[model samples]
Target: MQARYYTLNEARAALPVVKALMSQVQEARSEILRLRPEIWPVLQKAAHNGGNAAAGSVYSQFDKLETGVKGILKMGILVKDIDMGLIDFLSIRNGREVYLCWKHGEEDLSFWHDVNAGFGGRQPIDPEDF
Candidate 1:
């Protein structure tokens, strides 16, 4: 699918919904990590011996994680890091695509960076630039 670009105002307006979704993504990610070790053992057991009953719960957690991530991507927002809760919105700046960078815990979307630059390259958004 073609990428969707958000105007500055639109990006800012979407923050609340984005924040909520990111929270779900973060929770799902943490649960997945916590279940990883258990999941592998269960899978190994199932491989050798018919099936492991515990595998269903582990797979359910993975399904939720995948669904949450797909929901975010479907909105045209990039999930940069689940642990960091970092996300970006595609936007146009100076006639080219850039990222409106945001991380969890921030009160607002106040930074942006070039397409090739990551979080370290973020610059404060100038009110006039929008």
Candidate 2:
């Protein structure tokens, strides 16, 4: 993970894709939460082993989808900056900060990392995954 900065236009151009990915992330989150009641105990059991095995699976999927979307957009995203995080735009639904991952390509915004980790660590997105 490296710090890849982005220009405003580059960030804006990828908005649609970012929005779509955000939608998936939200859906994954919703699904995780919806299933939490049934998942909690299993997750708790796994936590006993010092690992969030149960929840980790779901969370990994969520993170994958989230990162996948960010990667497609080729943006270095920080939902929040040195001061805040995604919480600031939580109410806006679809709002995300995709910083620049690279400077060019159809996959210009070819990767996305996390708010905490920033753009330096974007994982590739397989076209088939979309």
Candidate 3:
């Protein structure tokens, strides 16, 4: 499918929903991290025994993480990194397609980069330029 390119205003409008979904994703990720140490032992024990019941919580958090990411993608946003909560929206700038980038803690949509440039290449959004 073709990418959905957002106009500057449209990209701004999508931020709220993206932020909410990112929150959900981050929370689920935190839970997964907290539970990470326990999983290996449980799996090792279950290897000798039958299925382990103790892993349910960790698996459920994975489910939540997947669901939250899907919600963001359903809106046509690119999920760049789950742990960092980075996402990008396709946008047109100077007649070429670039990414309008946002990280989880950012207060507003104010950065963008070339299609090939990752976060390190981020440029500030000029008011007059989309």
Best by lDDT: 3
Q: Least accurate stretch of 10 residues (summed lDDT) in model 3?
A: 45-54
Cα deviation in Å at residue 118, candidate 2? Answer: 16
| Descending-lDDT candidate ranking | 3, 1, 2
* Candidate 2 lDDT tens digits, 26-127: 566666777688768876777545655557667776686567545543444434321111211111112554333332213344454444555456555333
Selected candidate, larger lDDT, 1 vs 2: 1
lDDT by candidate, in order shown:
0.82, 0.47, 0.88
TM-score of each: 0.84, 0.43, 0.90
What digit string (tens of lDDT, one per residue) describes model 3 on residues 1-130? 2359998899899899989989989999999898778786886777546545547877788898999999889888899988789999999998899999999999999999998999899999985877
- Estimate the TM-score for candidate 3: 0.90
Candidate 1 per-residue lDDT over residues 48-94, each given as its tens digit: 46545456665676677677777778888898887898989999888
Instruction: Point out where model 3 deviates above 4 Å.
Output: 44-54
Extract clashing residue pairs from model 3. none
In candidate 3, position 65 carries an lDDT of 93
